[model samples]
Target: TQVTCRNSLKNPLWSLIEIPIISSVTCQTVTGLIFFQNDFCARILLLELKWCVLCLLLNEAELQQRSPPSMISLAGGSPNPNTFPFLSASIQVKNGRTVTFDEATMKRALQYSASNGIPELVTWMKNLQKNLHNPPTASYSPEKGQMDMCVTTGSQEGLCKVFEMLVNPGDNVLLDAPTYSGTLTALRPLGCNLINVPSDQHGMIPAALKKVLSRWDPSEVHKPDSTAPKILYTIPNGGNPTGASMTAERKKEVYELARLYDMLIIEDDPYYFLQFEKVQRWLTSSVSVPFPWAPTFLSMDVDGRIIRTDSFSKILSSGLRIGFVTGPKPLVDRVVLHIQASTMHTSSFTQLMVSQLLHSWGQEGFLQHIDRVIEFYRKQRDAMLSSADKWLKDVAEWHSPSAGMFLWMKLRGVADTQQLIVEKALEKEVLLVPGGVFMINSSDPCPYVRAAFSLSTPEQIDEAFKRLSLLIKDAL
Candidate 1:
């Protein structure tokens, strides 16, 4: 067995220490130490203090090589920035030699960043949050104990740090079944038994969650006690694969459940700004999402159980790898400690570029851009849905997504969708997510597939689904 924890000095007498625990077991190190319950596999001694810095700069080729083949070929949940001409204009770099290269925003980006994020970027995000929700004052700080924000490599890293801070080995975590797979991928290594909850067409069912929590028995071996869930992970806005957006009423109901149960709600809203046109129309008009925009759970939070993670990848560029988290200062402070120990900080260059772009755009410009992007996806979603209605209604069924890119199809009488895709669909050059991949347990049959129209063009979408329908027929 292996034991790991944050670094500390066990004894002051020695500059370095190596303590033999039992027969061959040992605890050793100067800067940090590892305790082993079994015989040492290997041992090394260093006399001089040496330091080295390593940086991994990944370009498109490196990213493609490192990322899973399935992920690279899919019309994923992120925007294709190459399709957006305006974003390219913002990314232009004539030179890093002088501050006056582009003469306007380029000069501002060369400067170092503020501790939390660029001050102006924080202000822009604050104001955008305010407009999204009609909240009081809309001022939240990265200091004090109430509210704060920390920039991260991406929401993946944010979730990793959050898990590091909150989850102890053997703890029980409540996650939405068919949830974001990345969250499962990151947390599984930490040794928590993820309890998957059932969701319907409306996203996470609060009633189902209540039942699960109520049924949890702490006294059972390998079970967590009744203290409360370590965290309640949710992606209320355009949930992954399913594309379900919680209604405002639903948000309130879930919020009440979270408060009553005393569980921290992690509102992962990477696709918050990417709602479908119909959903956008509803929100901008009379209908609103169950969760409030901007301050979100933090706004409704009375006891500080809401922590929201926002990502720039969906609407902006994923290569930038920028995201932020807002929540109670205590939790965020702990996260910052992890950040300090690991990343030191998110990419300063990327942060500066984002800060400069947002500052130039201002809140109103930013809102307009979000609206435009929403409109673009809205058209794509409608086209895909129309195609599915014509080609899939007799064989497969799907609810029209309220927001986000994917149109999740529950295939009738189809099992082993993953195998079907590998054997048949790829041969036809059409790629889609096999629903089982999204589950916490990938062993069982999920009879569902997620088709994204986000990255694909309107012209290609119909052909894609038509080919997919043929594959489904062949599989049957």
Candidate 2:
């Protein structure tokens, strides 16, 4: 039996050709027969046949090389196996269960590994993401060419890599007004023009975003050479400095706007699990209500344009330096290639430890841990809110944050918080980040200031607010 192989050639010299597969003969025999039958066109087809055969052979070799280690790899520059010192390692978890990494696991952890990340840890993270975000599609295999995940040193690292991947030096990038200061720092050195989209208590206002994009005139604006923004970076839940989260409806609106404008949405959500709206019921009762994490921008992504970056830093340990990026495969592949050349991989030791911890916790245990964390932060938030009401109510105004670790206050009569930070607040021994730091144009006058209640006790929060209130009063 013969199978038909069709080759579509669009070159001006040739057209499509259909050839029957000769199962009885080699590719070389087929090529010779084609060349004998037709002149130039047959030669082109024969060359294509040879090229296809070569590709098949190369692919087979790669598959064999990547398969289980049956033969020693003398071709590559892998580190010597015997030189590694660690034999085994162990750690104790919260529930008094101890997890140990044996010799085999230790070897994988210590040595150089895949650029994307360790398979086991990536799989666990992918599963966790599926359970939490419930994305449009779930993809575990990069070979499938669908949405995939890659681990980074932290979400910060992921953000930097993504900016490098997407933004040219003179390109314009959109950000929420009063964005994360860290993001400003990251993008400043790249020479990309930063365009601030107006935001409200519900995060980036969809209407404002649409207006900015619709009215964008490159020639009339300051940066004439810069192109229109191709990306919008946002922290959907409890934005840093702003402490505002977009509602589900708002996220859908923004997602639709992104589609309309033809742009990518970078959702940097480290505080997704820390939302405090339902914490009271979860804290007061024994039975856990399903974790009420806000719907992420990724959940609304129908075109796979949302790149969601998450971290274990806030929920687990900041020192862990582990985060994952979930997005379309092409973007993730570029990030992986960058990682391969740059950091090589996030700390294998940290990846191993995090993987073990997640494995031990399971889904239920993980939810329980987040609940405990939220309860703790909820108390601090209450303390801050109460203190603000008591001491700063007349002088400053702020919206109560529903998630993450900040209170963004707008003082009534202040022109800029930077002057207060430098001259008044510091003198009064109240350390808070000035709002200008979070602005796209840092030199602009800003009355807002970001105060974090994450690390302070109730008494301490009260004291800090009292001091801050006094400073604001004196400034007024």
Query: Which numbered prediction scores highest in TM-score against the true structure?
Result: 2
Score candidate 2 by lDDT. 0.74
Range of the 10 consecutive residues with the lowest summed lDDT in candidate 1:
40-49
Per-candidate Cα lDDT values, in order, are 0.64, 0.74
Q: TM-score of every model?
A: 0.72, 0.81
Model 2 pairs in collision:
none
Model 1 residue 153 distance off true place after TM-score fit, in angstroms: 1.4
Best lDDT goes to which candidate? 2
